[model samples]
Target: MERIYLDNNATTIVDPVVKEAMDPFYCQMYGNPNSLHSFGTEVHPYMKIALDRLYSGINARDEDDILITSCATESNNTVIKGIYYSLIRTGRKSQVITTQVEHPCVANSCRFLESLGTDVVYLPVNEDGIVTPEILREYINPDKTALVSIMWANNETGLIFPIKELCKVTHENGALFHTDAVQAIGKIPVNVQETGVDFLSFSGHKFHARKGVGGLYVRKGTDLPTFMHGGEQMASRRAGTIDVPGFIGMGLAMELAVRNLEYEATEVRRLRDKLEDAILSLKDVLVVGRREIRTPNTILASIRGVEGEALIWDLNRSGVAASTGSACASESLESNPTFVAMCISDELAHTGIRLSLSRFTTEEEIDRSILVIRQSIERLRNISSR
Candidate 1:
């Protein structure tokens, strides 16, 4: 049986071109970027080139605005805690605002900050899993707000948030804005300059680059405290010896993504809509946030009376790979908080399954996946009824 992987939101397979771009850095150019030796000097220019590519990929104003990190988790932690700590010293703003549907990293970071006696507000989303600018204005106050961290696109429901407008609101209140764009970076156009976000976090593996590498876009002049403490790497913003091969792969991946973004958006959206239509044709099934503005490659559907884990297992046996929710929170038995925040019933939330596509996802895979999902949901429903 052929395997159909539809878990792009969890992670993506590394592109062969990106792998090839990383080959030289692994063995031939194995020199510490901070070293002064000629071998190291040769490696430095490649890092510069990678930074330049990333800058172009996001339309960043300057290369220095980007800080290389291990993953979006670290970046999220840095932004939330960094801003909180910086402001705590000056006794200025003490409130941090974020949506209820944030990823585990950002959500937990806020929880942790709250434990430290900081005011953290988790704004609720609408039934469509969105936080409108009007709702944001209610919580934002220039006198006491420090940071507003929201995600650009949700990983589970694929709902796209109004980051550009939200950032403007944040700035008007004299607060910095951060967006976890891990799922949105390659799937949508992300121009940092246009958005005016003070900080943005994105991971490599989400965009066909190698895992264990990601970036934090810190707007120039943002007073963000450093997260890591070691050698003066990442212009003293982040510390540690950089992963040369990973950065090279990420740069190549970003370059490829920017070049193929239009094609990717069209193709993935077509396949996703096809899958959604087929799944919705089945009885007693509902697509989460279907009418909302979402990413091009995600479909979160709920099949009544069927458990998501059971459906996923059945699909896996049939050579179809999918997910229940965010990969980071999959280990937990609890239902997806995003659905709960939307006030979806427990039965529907428990049955939610997410299928996220990629540029490499083929139409045939989507067709097969739809068939497999229909069969799995039917079989599971039959079993539950019995």
Candidate 2:
């Protein structure tokens, strides 16, 4: 049986072009980007070219606006905690605002800040998991609002947030805007210049790059609170020498991912829609969220009366790999709060399975997946009836 992968939303496979691009950096072009020697300076140009490619991918014109980290999680932590500390030192941080449906990285960071004397407000999302600017206005105070951290896309349902309009609201109130773009970067365009977001977080692995590389985009003129203080690297924002290969691979992945975004997005959306249509037509299967407004490569469906974990196991036995929620917290026994926050009924939430397609996911896989899903649901339902 051919194994079908449908969890691209969790992470994607590295592109061949990205690997080819980073080959020289690993063996021949190996040099510290921070070194002042000739060997190091020679590789700096390639690194600069790489950074420029990433800027174009994100539509960020200023290269200085980007700060490379290990992954989007670090980016989120650096930005949320970094900006919060900066505000506190300036006597501006009394509270921070974020949505309840955010990834654990942002949600937990806010909670950590709250634990240390700062107030954190978790705004609620609508039925479709949309956070309106009205909710921002209702909760924000001009005198003490320091920063607002929100996600660009929901990992479960692929519901995109209005970063552009919402960021405007936060900025107008004198609060810095930060967005976790981990799921939005390669799947969609994320131009900080256009969105007016002060800080943006993204992981290279999410976009076909290496696992240990990601970045936080801090807009020019924004002061970042220091995270690491030992090494002189990263202009003192974060310490230690950069991962040369990871950085090169990340930039390569971003460049190549953008080249195919337009074509892949159209095709992925077609395949994803077909998958959703096929599954939802089955008896008692409910397609979650707005049918057409979701991500191009993701489909989250609820099989009425079956459990998600059980369904995943059966599908795996049948040669399909899937996920229940964010890969970061998948091992935890806690229920997925994203579905709960959306108010999906306990029975439905228990059975909700996330099938995220990718540029590499073929049409045949989708067809085979539909059959497997139908069989699994039927079997599980029958077992329960017995």
Residue-wise C-alpha lDDT for candidate 2, range 1-386, written one tens digit per residue: 88999988888888777777878877787778777887688888878887888888887867446877888888888888886678864676688899888899998988898888888999988777688898888998888888888899888888888899899999889999999988887777778888988888899988888788998788888888777666777777778788877888898888877886885679988889988898879888877788555767778888877778888989999999988742233577677778778776666557788999888889899999989988988899899862
What TM-score fits each model?
Answer: 0.96, 0.95
lDDT agreement of model 2 with the native: 0.83
Report the Cα RMSD per candidate. 1.8, 2.0
lDDT of 1 at 204: 97
> Model 2 clash tally?
0
Give the distance in Å from residue 148's predicted Cα in candidate 1 to where it truly belongs.
0.3
**CA shift at 360, candidate 2, in angstroms?**
0.8
Spell out the clash pairs found in candidate 1. Answer: none
